[model samples]
Target: MTAIVVAGGGLAGAAAAAALARAGRDVTVLERDAAPAHKICGEFLSVEAQASLAAIGFDAAVLGGHRISRLRLVRDDAAVSVGLPFEGLGITRRRLDAALLDHAASCGAVVRRGVAIRGVDCSDGLRLDLAGEAPIRPDMLLLATGKHDLRGVRRQAAEPEALVGFKMYFQLNPAARQALAGHIDLILFDDGYAGLQMVEDGMANLSLLVDRARLQRVGGTWTALLADLVKRNTLLADRLIGSVPLLEQPLTIFRVPYGFVHRPTANDPDRIYRLGDQAGVIPSFTGDGMAIALHSATRAANAIIAGHTASAYHRALRRDISGQIRRAAALYRLARMPLAQRALFGVAGTFPSLLRLAAQYTRVPPRARSALY
Candidate 1:
């Protein structure tokens, strides 16, 4: 069998390569970054994500991830807290990705770092043009660039993307840590929400998803926008009272398409499989994007091993994940509306099980029952 080439060595790519190589298939992974580093992510691992990681043999607890058992939603002075339906973990992507890539390498997959895919030509086979290197043609290609698009295999253009995301890591004070331990907070404001959870290394990850126009109107700079948000969001302001940023600048990504789901096209000829954010973009507040990425990789690998067509795999994946994506999208829209946000909070406060129900609905279905599996 010819070597399978996976572009963008992220969670999806590395996981897919590891699974394929372990199955005795030759696999090669192309990564743009030379080393493991932080990416723009919420870093909350759902129960399904944990299961997938365990299936691949990397323990989140062993890697210093923090346990998260509760969900806290805060808006103005009103707040609602409920136990999560399942145990979750908070771990930095840097640590997780590094471990996964190492696992792939150990499984005999050729892990090529510092190589960016310039474009792909599939007229003959699958030709990958790498940065500063000769083209390589492989038997199959997996696109797992997360939020990025390669030169020739971009997603179909939809409506203009207007969501902007910002992320920062901070060392919280003792009191703040005590208050936030074992919990993930979703703090809502005018046009966005910030997800806060303590990851490994004893630092808090604060990820924000906001409307581009709203952020621009507030100030247009991270510091200014944050200050403006903090002024109106008392919960976030309290959490940051004595915290200090771990980095000099916050990570930011613009034009985030929060509800995108890619469908298979009729004209496609390449044996290309799209994974993770390349396949779909769930609302960040739902906190299952990583789960989707990891699970999708496993499913894709299974399909490839079973000699399934790329389109067939794509259709099955869409069928499996479309409900979660749609439900999350509806919640995302409702959460952004002020009155609806207050109403939902009231309902959750009165019947906390509703929140748990939503969580169950948004999760990636168990792998055993998954169609692709």
Candidate 2:
């Protein structure tokens, strides 16, 4: 059997490599980073995401550092809290990535760290150019490089422009921690949305997602914009100000791009496949990015094991990922509209039951609604 080459050793790549190895295929994963690194994220997984993780036999205990049972939607002075039908897990990217990598290695995958992929040629089989080592040719090439564009792939012109993400860890006062325990708070303002949740080590993870223009309007620094947001949002100010202590230097990820690939490589139907963010990214607000990637990887591996062609894998990926992306995009677009945002949140706050119903809707699997009730 020909070896499968997976690029980017993040969650998606590692998961895909593991799945393929488990299916009795030789897999090699090339990662630029040597080990798990810190990343900026909400760190709160929805119930649906947890279910996906469980399906892959991942132990929830590894993510038990911080567990939340409530989801709070906040706007200015008013807030509505809804108890999640199921609990959500909170784990840092560092821990999650390390766990996935370890699992992939144990499953017989050859993980090559500190190796950067200079470029790829998919015309004749799959050729990968490494920075220091001689070029390698593999039977299949999987692109899982999250948010980073590779040179050969053709990106759609109509895709959404990348957004910026800012995050940091902090220690909160005992009173504040007590109030925030078992709850994930989402704060929405005119600029964008910010989320707060507790993670391992008795610290809270705070993240802000904002457009570049809005960041500029508030002064380039996220700290500056955050301060302004706090001043405008009294509830958030009261809960965090003077109580939360910064745990690490605030981190920022610029131009985190996302979109779909309309045209799969026509010339090379035998070798090329896209996975994870490289395939496309769902809006972060939906909290399903990692789950979608993992699910796609599994589906792709199954297709390969069944001896299906690359075109079949492409169609399957589109079918699985497009629906969720559309739903998330619609919700994100609605949130961007001032009037719609006000009305949606206003209605949600007025009728707590409605919020619960929405959560249920979000939690339902794509084709398993009959089983959900």
Candidate 3:
């Protein structure tokens, strides 16, 4: 059998490579970065993500990240706290991706770092064009580049009103730290919302999304936009009282095609398999992106092992997660509307179980039954 080539050594790529290599199929992972670095992500691992990681032979419990047992929604002064259906972990993508890729290497997969892919040509088999390197054509290819599109396989155009995202790390004051322990806070303000949670050490990850117009109106600078948001958001203001920023500046990602789901097309003659954000981009607030990546990795691996067509795999993944993605997108829209935000919060406050139910519905079905194994 010809070796399989996976682009982007991210959560999905590394996990899929590990699964395929462990099953005695040759696999190679190509990552552009020479070393692991932070990526723009919420970094919250749900139960499904954990199970998929375990199936890929990685132990998430040993990652030393924070334990998040509940989710709290805060809007100005009104707030509601609800129990999360499952305990989640707060670990950065930098750490998680590095560890999982290392696991792939240890599991007999050839892991190649600092190798950038220019594009893929499938007219005759699969030809991968590399930057300043010789091209190789493999039997099958898996595209796992998260939030990024390879030159040949980009997703459809994102909605015009795409949101801008920002992420920063901080060491909160004693009072704020104690108050935020064991919880993931989703704070809302005008035209945007933020999710803050503890991860690993005493450090906190604060990731926020703002409408593009709102960002442009504030001078199109991270500093200006963040200051305005903090002033308008009471809960976020309190959390940053005495915090020190860990990064010189926040990491930002652009052109995020939120709610994008890949459907097999006639142009996919290369039989390329799309994974992670390439497969679908669920709204970030739902915190199911990582789970989808892990689950997609295993499912894709299974498909290849079973000699299934790429279109068949794409259809199955789309069928499995389309409803969850749509529901989360609707919730994201409702959370942004001023009037609907208040009403949604009111309902969530009245029946906290509703929040749990939303979480359950937004998540792709668990893999324990299990297609992912």
TM-score of candidate 2 relative to the true fold: 0.91
Stretch of 10 with least lDDT, candidate 1: 364-373
Better of 2 and 3 by lDDT: 3
- Candidate 3 lDDT over residue span 1-373, tens digit each: 7679999999999999999999999999999999999988888998889988998779988989999999998988888998899999999889989999999999999999999999988777889999999999888899998877788777774662468899999999998888889999998887888899999888899998898888999999988987887788778888899789999999987667767888778777646899999899998999999999988898899999988988989989998888899899888888888899888888988998999999999998764227556
State, as a TM-score between 0 and 1, how close model 3 is to the true structure: 0.97
TM-score of each: 0.97, 0.91, 0.97
Clashes of each: 0, 0, 0
Q: What is the lDDT of residue 64 in candidate 3?
A: 93
lDDT of 2 by residue, 238-284 (tens): 66766655654678886654445334556644666777777667767
- lDDT (0-100) at residue 126 of candidate 1? 79
In terms of lDDT, the poorest run of 10 residues in model 2 is: 364-373
Residue 214 of model 3 has an lDDT of 87
Residue runs of model 3 more than 4 Å from their true location after superposition:
157-161, 367-369
